[model samples]
Target: MGSIKPAKSLLYLAISMVIGGTLLNVNELAYLAVFPLILLAMGLFVEPPSGIKIERIVEEKTYIPGDEVTIRVKVMIERGMGMVLLRQPLPPEVELVKGNNAWSLFKGPRKLEKELTFSIKVPRRGLYTLPPAELYIEPLLKLGKPGTAFLGNPVTITVLPLIKPPRRVRTTNTRSQIPIPLTSYSLTGPISTDFKEIRDYRPGDPVKFINWKATARRGNVLVNEYEREGKKTVMFYVDARPTMSVGTFQENPLEHAVSLVASLAYYFLRRGYNVGLYIVGRGELMMPSTGNRQLYAMVKKLMEVEVLSSANEDFKDAMRKSERIIIQYTPLIIVVSNLLQANELREAFRLLMKHYKGRVPSIVFDLFPYSMFSGKKVELVRLRKIAIERELKAISHVVHWDIRKTEISAVLAKTIRMVR
Candidate 1:
């Protein structure tokens, strides 16, 4: 509603009545004459005219939850003769920690122009609106008149969700790229590689086979030696399976897993080894490759990985083929997954060595510890859940990882140390 203003003549009548009544009794003046004259003066003079306008501006367009943002309101008034009060309205989620009460009075009016700025923190992630401002004005008269009012337009702010790294991780029992010893190799000549270590010298030892350090420690000479093998390849198998979604909220487990895969790819590529990747569970395959380009491709893939549904296909066939690839072209394989499926996990890894052209060294990153999936109480009666966990651990030796309720970077660092 607009400001309420009583007719000025009302005040004049009350003033004139008192003055005329006293004068008629004491000075013998005409009461009607004095009252009518004062009333006419009040009605003839017009109250000062006024108008107000408000413009709003914001400091930022996007922010994460709990981020601070400032909003500025510029108030302008024209020919405003009187006291003007302005009050800014704010959203329910926004707290006006600064500025005057919903109202600020502009004393002794002239033309008024001002830019009032305020700041607020984004408490939640979503869209929000800035409330309107209430403008009030009152003429400088003793008549006790009401003030004018107006509501400004609404403003909107959008907040984005928080993407934080995990504290720990849960690794699954999947195939990996560790070195495996070969069983069917013919000796080309005498062993000539650098000495690795020396135990008691085997029978039929050559006179030059003695190790001085071993002799001093064991009271007898021990020989140290090494075997020769061709250069080996390193491949990373990431189980991006649907079943891997046991633990995650706004930040999915796959995001962290993908980072690990990408990092390993970079390291292997830098080491002059052919680094390849096998992505299981999402029905997509990235065969192993080496070079900077390959590493970037891996990072791009990992960045876009979304969690798979429960019905997503398995990588058992890929696991079987991994053996041959390792024997013919690769020597090391690193498997990373949340080992939620025991049989599938076992079969995938077992087939690697069993079906490979040669022995394959492997390290499994087992993302178990279903406890990390949630803080709520887990039902023990879920026979399938229990069975899956049991099979996961029994299938292959896995490097256990639990990424639940922890910072992602810290957990990844720990996992890297463990694998090393």
Candidate 2:
């Protein structure tokens, strides 16, 4: 206790004064010793104030990366108290955007109830816990020491990934060579296999689709109409190996991959398509579903992604394991990888062919390394560029994308156009 040292010094001083005063017959010294003894006695009997309480309120439990969060801390003292110091340690994933995290309050002779509020900016996506606030209460008597107590309960917050709304990528059938507008699949356009009525035939109408009975009755070229087809299933593969950790946070391959996946998943889910995720990071994570719930789950998983230096997860092995799931859903596969090696791309393509039997449409997003390491390490960047070009040439048969020159949405739009 802070009071122990001062109390002990006073007691020692009192004893020395009394002994010296008795030997030297000095009455002033003896009288002076009485003050020290009385101070020590009073300090030893002082009691710390009880019934102190602390409450904490967090404005929200979830946030996106770079969002500012507000935290309010309230301290209530049932009785008058002395000086108090309060502190709350923040998680390293966030930065103080406004206000202080620690404060010292000098309590007067009155009961105190005060509130402090501060804001922090989330730097990255992840789950973080705010540690409890600590209060150090100094004793009323100067000779007494301060006592420490923990206040407030720990609070958990989930920071979701930063999502950039992606441009719509129109869906196309596996065999269709023409792209159809998404609006065509609604009630206004023709739905596959569900007949609505017969209408006058237009130019380019298929002869096979013409209704002989309707044509004969109307005495004009009439064709059968149908409702639009249902939504398609889409699967996304995010490559999160250590190689993706290259570059700074602003341009890191992994960061870009997370943004891309979040944006794509959000776009497709909103369009009523079944979306699934297969993340190849420190471990294999899969979320095979659709709708807004699935989108949230996929983004949460991506938010917690970390690059493991010792991880050697084989791309072929991850793809092989995903084949069974992919076949069951029959989803349109989209692979987001850095494509640093030719063999990795070949192996991924091999697995897709094996599972889909060349009947399903697949797209690969090649995150070029040069875009991430711009203006640094000239020789290494050149080598990486050469390797990427070689790999691209080797896998010319598959539909591939270079996303360096455009936003993820534009690249996705281009892929949809090409496939359609």
Candidate 3:
């Protein structure tokens, strides 16, 4: 706040003139300079700006790498007359596409409103928070101290991974049969003849759902759990460990894998399949559901997904909790990750194979981030990749994706064996 008067250039000039006029005995010049000092002193009565407010408005927020977002930042300075300076600090990863983040303007009297509009391109995936707006108001006459204020509300943007539509290559009347053990089971749902497990009857159990045979054998009342059709669920297991951070942050293996997951989720959800996601980092399952809302939920979670700094992920625990869902929906499994030198990834596959009873038609979008690196071992990585492919091929349809050489869509087109 500008609560005290500070001597300005005009005050100093007037003092110098009076001192000179005393030595020279010239009253007219000193009196004229005194008028300037009096006017400058009147500026101290002007209050510094207060009631400063800032608001951020975003338009058509398309959150993905390389996508531009238009941001409109408005500032309302309601109190003092001054020169206004407003600044909105952006993260280093965000690039300005147009306009400016900082602007300076002259302000006068009551309610001065200003707008700083710009377009920015976010270059990576993560949760980004733009710092609070900073406002500096200096007196219009430059005769008093300036005032500063900050609006503490920050703007947070979650940049989700980009999804590229897979190239569709449809075949007629032919399905690829691979060698894998297959089994069938059922879990809870409505309107299907498939029998789920039998359990002791609860109060709400219908008489029709009673398993008389099991009741007779166990000597206890039992009711059958049910399964249904007309709705399907696809569960995605995204491996987001630091290993997926193989290339540059923007073009790394994890980024592409996340995008692949998003695209697959979108594709299946668009067809009315109830979709779910299990991010390996946090190991939380997004329950399966169908709709624009489900897709929104999945993408929103995916936007917050990042390659964790620690590798201590619990894949088995995450899977165990999701086992009932796996059995209930008999969902087609899609595991997205970079498998090179990843022992955890291999273990995850072995664990997953047991669930859908080795028959959960699964797809592994295996990332090849070898060539993206520079070293003599690039060739060695390529060799080891083949061995890993053999292991994955035993249980799932493997799409070998070379990030340095190809896009995810192309690999899917060539090797996509969609189970649903």
Candidate 4:
């Protein structure tokens, strides 16, 4: 039912006119009082617009960070309106790009419908909900107070992290790029174009593998053999401790760690390997699996990651808890974290080694948050970072990743190359 209440301003005016008329013994004042009283009486009988409805349509419910999102909101009212306003509050990380998210316009007492369109840019990765559109109606004659109603149902959008390609690092003395080898095993696995060698053609070999140049040189049929990629389980350990919150929220150790985990998960999933995740402080895990579904699931978990100031989840304890899964999967363990204390990491690695029969090949990525300092602090932080990296190397393959100087994928490739 439509909701309408008499305007308090009009009620006070009516009361004042009546009191003045009686005190002054003026008939004109009494007649003048009738105007506001009539308006109040009419307000009691009237109602605000009814049958209001709003529906929100998002162009894509899922988006990558820094991508623009288009939104269309439709408002429909069956009958009765003075001025109708529709507005909705957006998530803090979202910024307007195209049109207004709020709409205000005069409407007559008839069926009213309008479609409002706008665009927004999502800057960060997370699951965000757009609040329901609010509909406010004001009586045309100023006879009744304004009425408010929440219109549309909330819409949720998932902002996924951007996946960037691997970047190469520059060397002081060499111009050649580092070779990235993706090792594969098994006879039936996918083969890389990286030709291993040309051998005499074997029976039942695919004709497409014939190397014409080698055949002409030797005067015999030869086949090119390529590197065969094999499957492996990769478990990612992403530290969520407070120490990772170093630098700005937009560019921090924690942010890079999450993105690094996501990108690596993507890299492995495409290679037919099962990937698992362990959010260190959060204790969230995704059992090892393969395919785009796994990538999506991993990214979904990563999108929810945030640096908590109070979660003091022990690294050693986290490793111990996942000992069973680690043994079962026999995954290449990947740890993404900032250097806490050198001894603390050694303890964590010790617990990890206890579960494996042999040394489990593990890589530890240490993020140097360059954004945390200016000119003077750089040299000092650099020296401290090197010391930490040096200490960490004794326990695991350490990849020193400065946020400004390197890409996550590049450092990851470098680490993987070193492991190989």
- Candidate 1 C-alpha lDDT tens digits along 107-214: 444667778777777664456787777776665442235466665778878764433433323467343223333322212225656554576778887768787867
- Model 2 C-alpha lDDT per residue in residues 349-391, reported as the tens digit of each score: 6666654434345556667646534565745755775666566
Top TM-score: which candidate number?
3
By summed lDDT, which 10 consecutive residues of candidate 3 come out lowest?
Answer: 178-187
lDDT of 3 by residue, 281-378 (tens): 66768988889999888888887777887757656666777887876766776777777654655565566666554444767778888886778798
lDDT of each: 0.58, 0.70, 0.74, 0.75
Per-residue lDDT for 207-236 in model 4, tens only? 999999989999999999886654667778
Model 4 segments more than 4 A misplaced: 1-47, 165-231, 354-359, 412-420
The CA lDDT at 235 in model 4 is 79
- lDDT for model 3 comes to 0.74
Candidate 1 deviant stretches above 4 angstroms: 1-231, 247-249, 310-312, 321-324, 355-360, 368-396, 405-420
Candidate 1: RMSD to truth:
13.9
TM-score of each: 0.43, 0.72, 0.79, 0.72
Positional deviation of residue 111's Cα in model 3 after best superposition, in angstroms: 5.4
* Candidate 4: C-alpha lDDT: 0.75
